[model samples]
Target: MRADRLVSLVLLLRQRGRLSAATLAHELEVSTRTVLRDIEALSAAGVPVYAERGRHGGFALLPGFRTELTGLNHDEALSLLVAGLGRGEQVFGLGSALASAMRKVVDALPEGSQATASDAARRMLIEPETDLLARRAAVDEVPGDVAAEVRRAVFAGHKLRLHYAAAGRPPAWRTVDPIGLVTVRDRGYLLATRSGEDRTYRLSRVLAAEELPEPAERPDHVDLDRIWRDRSTRFRAGGDQVAVELRLRPSRREELAGTALAVLAEAAEADGVGGAGGADGADGADGAGGWLRMTVTFQDARHAEWALWQLATDAEALAPPSLRTALRDRALALAARYDTPP
Candidate 1:
């Protein structure tokens, strides 16, 4: 790792011509003392690095010095940089290293291609840093040290001890064999198994983590993609799997479909469609307001109630007494609250 950091320091010097020790320390995520030590090390190793004292002056390599780094062609360099154009790297606790690598990749390009590629990259937007709906999306805050421990356990094929906080349950320590780490929309997850049973934990929810020295109990070869898919399938089906029938204005179809966990059946027959909203899957809706009838599956009754509540008067729950009653109770509560004389 020190060697890699040394190389990165040299690359930074080569790329920017000159950078202050403080700047180098910030970029390398190291102390200024470490930067001074590395400078001395590089100079002793026959690297023509020198320092100058001034407000603008800092460390610099000999003029016309360029390390023959990895040879990445123009498009290859651009593609690599574009792939990491988001905060996805932060989820895995590699943002600083990734940024250094990206710079190195760009600097490795042919001088003519470097500027062109950079300009093109500036024009392209991947997961813009700011969210339009909110005051920028709130970052999923996972402890850096814990994420490092989780990654080490996963990559080293070791078991891990986790202090996890599960919703509606007390925080407890758990021992799990980590399978892989995944990050989606900036949220990180550790997919593992406990006693051969699948377990997944949100990295943000981990209160503490420790990598166990003992070898993990896991398969010889791991197909993380396949493993994640299988786990996701089981997780989606493991819940209450509540089914509901709904009639909604044609315009609200996208909103309803997007909110429901899954759509069991959907049809728009002329004015309306047939429906089934019970355990036996039998339902009926007589064309109302040219509405479309849909039988959709929710994670549970609570999920269905929450979603239909958003649709308000625009959508109607047609069957499944549980869902209808929940919505009715919610409506009554809202009415009572608003009707009470303040």
Candidate 2:
């Protein structure tokens, strides 16, 4: 742990020059006294670490000096190699570059450690293509040429004309002032605006793209994180927010949270459930005895219906009469269809 801390201290100082002992302790999650001792230790070890006293005084490394951590011991190299095995770079159109870098790192490893490192990294997986249940995440394929064009336009800060097919809508040409590209859950989206209206387009849905020489009318600097959050909030709020009260099992709380819905309230008790609970409990998530109730918001009635359909036996929708009635009607129709001899 001390070795790791020492390395972390060096890295922190290298990345952010001149940090007070207090700040160093905060960053390293240690005490100021520990930081001072580490500084002395680094100096003794010929690390050229120096300190200053006063209000603005702090610890810093010698000017114009830095260290490379490429001499990675077995586990370190394996970890780095494993990280590069993911297809994350593919979505950003950096697959070849990433592969080349990974190869270089592997080739540069100590001759004796090369085989061991590669074997270990190969045995492990990051973002596996299939889950334990044999479920595979769907990946959208964008034409290489099209993706290249869109990428170029985005970085060049230029307007883009796209032949986009949005959901059930037919393909149409639209000019957008491209802001940035974002990838989430293996899917990529282009954040942009049309006539000053915020618009988000799925990259896969872009059938064709052309870069315009005219500069895009976008802010010179953008807080994409904030913009993405604000856009998401607005999108969720603008739609029909039909809500459903569910009596779920204590175990499925995480699954519920991961969905595109918000839990408004919950009710869990000695049922081995945790935290405060006062949820409506018509029945369990499985329509059985035990239950932890929760009220969840959906985009709309249709959205609620679709999500509940997927949740199936794991969640029970108990609310607003209309929603329950809709589920019942759908269930009856399905049952009636199955009841037929054919």
Candidate 3:
């Protein structure tokens, strides 16, 4: 913990330019005397640390001086290098620049530390899940330069002219006042105001984006949280609330606790017949046979259908006759599509 604190202090000084001993002690949650002693140790280890006294008294490193990883004890250096590399291909651009940077950091490490770093690197390996990798690759294909420019314009309160394409629609050119960038899972979206109305455009669907010359006055207030909340509410309005009863297995019961829609009303032992459950008066001694009654409000029948599909044969919906009818209709429609003569 002390070593980590020392590293943090050095990094903080490097970022902030300088700090008085009292300030450093407060920031590091240590005594001023201890801070001074740590500074002495850093200087003794040839860290180029120095102190200034009087009215503007403080400790600082010479300008442009960075702590060399050579001072880290093996494990520390290796962990640092690996963590930097794990940021994916976005950082150092595609090519040998990243590899070269990693090599330099590793090569600068002390001999003993170098061996330890190598051992640590060998022991730690990160494997990207296949589905997640695919999603990331899709995001990576987006023009990074364009995204950066859009982000800058959003922060600077600049209007943007861009060619955009929405799902199942032809590309169209539009002018919008950029508001903010929102990242969800693996995709990025730009929230903007167009024709006095707010909209969200997926970054991947943006063909081209450039700042407009006519700078618009920044709004006095930008309520991003409210905008997002309203958007979500609108999306959920597609379907109405319908009661759903589920007979969840022990594992599925735990999983339901985390789901956004599942609301538990009652819990009892699962009935022997996996699909059917006894009403009100049921014994709890049916082995793993217990039923959990839940009320899930679906925005639309499609939402209920999808939820049912995900839960598979483990769960069932028990109310709102319209919901079951909609599910059956959808199933039959899909069956017809698959059953059609080729």
Candidate 4:
């Protein structure tokens, strides 16, 4: 217990520089006498900790004392740095702050560790195939600064007054109690409650956000994961759930296995064809060696249109005459536009 307390006291001193006895006692959930004893133990262990007496007195570390992380070996340091870089700028925010902070940490590493970390960074790269429509849609969705502020407010349980651009309308300013920030693929969304109604606002569509004096109360037992899972069903109105079958090539089947849609059903091999089931399995098949069949619920033909665009030529929709016709027409329109000479 003493060892644990000593470690925690060191961390607190490093993070906050100093702590009054009462503050330390509150944080450690111990009596002030115990906190005083822990401070004495830290000093005895040559931790360079001390306390001053008077109105402004508190426990503190001696100036220039450092907590050297000498325990981490070369491989450990490299692994951590490589992982941090792969998270991209959105997770860590833009600018050089993250990079700068990383540089300082790397610089403090043992000589060989820095080289290993640098090599690991050079060998690692993340590149996702570009989708122009999706990219444009994401860009038009939220600005980075507004998204960052919304994230901060969400975590701090603060209310925000946002000037937001609603779909097909002029921007309107409204007060929203920020609930959570959801990063769906490349898009950022804020799940909030306005006028007692739950709503999702695209961060890019926000023109401005101001902090409110009153902090919003977060709902108890709200499952964000479940909310996201039912997003399509929740957003759309009065559309028949259609079953569409798809025959994905073996390679594509492997790719789909890693996607969220794959969890809904199992893929089986039948007659030299892979048969994967989905929620709304519409019947159809092809001669492709590694193809799979799966069904997805579409609220309406319009929703199916969007799904078709995302699946592209990798999969096909083979049911609900309306959805099939919409996909065909859209493909034809795109072909015609491309065929026209510039």
Candidate 5:
């Protein structure tokens, strides 16, 4: 581990010259004392490292001294740099490795391309943690040791024992044959099998993990993408999805679709909200024209109610009498709660 840390230290200095000991300590997630010791270690090992003493002084390598790992074209290097700007590396405890690898990638590029690649990466932002609405996405936190053990079992083809806490269930231990690890939108999942039945466990829910000595019972070759797709399809079809017809402003259609499980149908208001509302005393229009009718599916009645509620008066659920009732009840309760000013 120290060796890796030392290599990382050198790479960081090579990538960002004249970084202060405090800066190095922050980057290395260590202490300034440790950084000083590492610098001493590098110097003792014949590395051409030198220090400057002043308010603006820090450690820097000698001119023309850089690690060589060349052989990447401009576009190729740019793509790598841009791809590395995402949070994918945070999954499975690979953040440190990803940082080190990116440093190496920058070092590998020709001098002329190094700045260009970094600039290109800065211009392209991917999967930001928050959206345009300022709503932050939830980040699932997985334990370092658990992720490492799970990754090892998955790669080494060893059986994995996981102390898992599934939704609505107590924590329990399970022995599974790890097939592979998958990361989507910064969330990690372990694809595995228990008693030959497919199982997918969210890494964040793994309280602990252990790699068993026995080899996993998995095929030598696997189409992980296809397997994940099939499992996702089955999961979507298995839930008790509730279908509801909604009359909403066209602008809010995307927002509704995002929360719903599926958009079964979409159509313009043929007669400008005339007869669009069903007979549960439904008043589809709040006097705003250009409403769109959609049949969307949600995981359950409660899910549909909650999603439509978020749109407030902009969207109105037209069908499933129960959903309208739930929304009305929620609106009344909310109004009553706010009836008294703070």
Candidate 6:
């Protein structure tokens, strides 16, 4: 650990130019004395480290001093830096390992590339876990230990036993041949096989996991991307899909598109700008500046109603009559329930 800290100290000064003992201690999570000692050790090792004096003094490397290491092009270094700093590090319980790897990547880059990569990384953001409204996207919370066990089984090629809580089903135990793990949009899935049948289980729904002693029965190599694509295609095509037409405020178009399985068609209403209309209007509702008319597909009738209802006054379903009736009935029930003060 001390060795790692010493290397990190050198990297820090090399990157930041000059840093006070207190700053180094804070960055390295050690005491000031430890920082001073590490500096002495680096100097003794002929690392070209020296100290500045007076009020604005700090430790710094000699001019043109840097460790000779493998080089990374600016773009390559920048990608690693951004990914290391982003939310992807939290996937599969590798946050600390990813951070360590990032430090090493920076240390390996050519001096000029290191500074440029750092600056570019600061300008880029990847896969932010929230939207413009400050609402966090739904990422299921899987316990770290459970995720680690699953990851271990996947890497070790062992069968896995899962105490899984599948949606709307009682928690049950099942053993499956470990294939691989896949993460999309911050959600994790275990792609495996059960009794020769393909299966994909969400990591968050895994209440507990046990790595089995026996080796998994599987191919030596697998194309995981193709497998995931095939499974996703089947899932999208197999659902109880319901297509609905809706006229909604332009501002709410994205919200609608996001929840829908597929957007079959979209066109702005020809009607001129007007005030917000109620769900009782001929096309359900129209907002000021008119509304966008879209034909979108949802997982089911229930899904369609729920998506539209989320927009409240900003949207209205103008659909296959049945959907409109369902929405009206739901609204009436809600209205009646809230009619009297509770």
Poorly placed runs, candidate 6 (over 4 Å): 1-86, 111-113, 239-241, 245-255, 263-295, 311-315, 319-322, 329-342
User: What is the Cα-based lDDT of residue 315 in candidate 6?
Assistant: 74
Count clashing residue pairs in model 1: 0
lDDT of 2 by residue, 1-342 (tens): 576568777866765679999888977668999998998998998898888779898988898665654344433333344345455455655543343345446545666786788789789877877999999977767776687788789889999999999999999999999998777777778999999999999989999999999999999999989999998888877867977877666667787777746778987635644222334343344545566778888888888887777776566776867877787799899999999899
Order of candidate numbers by TM-score, starting with the best: 5, 1, 2, 6, 4, 3
Clashes of each: 0, 4, 7, 10, 0, 0
RMSD in angstroms, all models?
6.1, 17.3, 15.4, 14.3, 4.2, 6.3
Q: 20-128 in candidate 3: lDDT tens per residue?
A: 9988887766899999889988888778778888888898888767555425443334334434444333321122223333444565666569668867877975535
Overall lDDT per candidate, in order of appearance = 0.79, 0.75, 0.63, 0.62, 0.81, 0.79
Summed over model 2, clashes come to: 4
The estimated TM-scores of all candidates read: 0.77, 0.65, 0.51, 0.54, 0.85, 0.65
Point out where model 4 deviates above 4 Å: 1-88, 91-95, 127-144, 219-227, 230-233, 236-287, 290-294, 306-317, 327-342
For model 1, the local distance difference test gives: 0.79
- In the range 34-127, model 5's lDDT, one tens digit per residue, is 9999999989988899999999999999988876533443323433543554565566776566566677677778889988998997898778
- In terms of lDDT, the best-performing candidate is 5
TM-score of 6: 0.65
lDDT of 4 at 326: 79
- Who wins the TM-score comparison? 5
| Backbone collision tally, model 3 | 7
User: Better model by TM-score, 1 or 4?
Assistant: 1
- Clashing residue pairs in candidate 4 are 141-204, 142-203, 142-204, 143-204, 239-299, 243-280, 243-282, 248-291, 248-292, 278-295
- In angstroms, how far off is 293's CA in candidate 5? 3.1
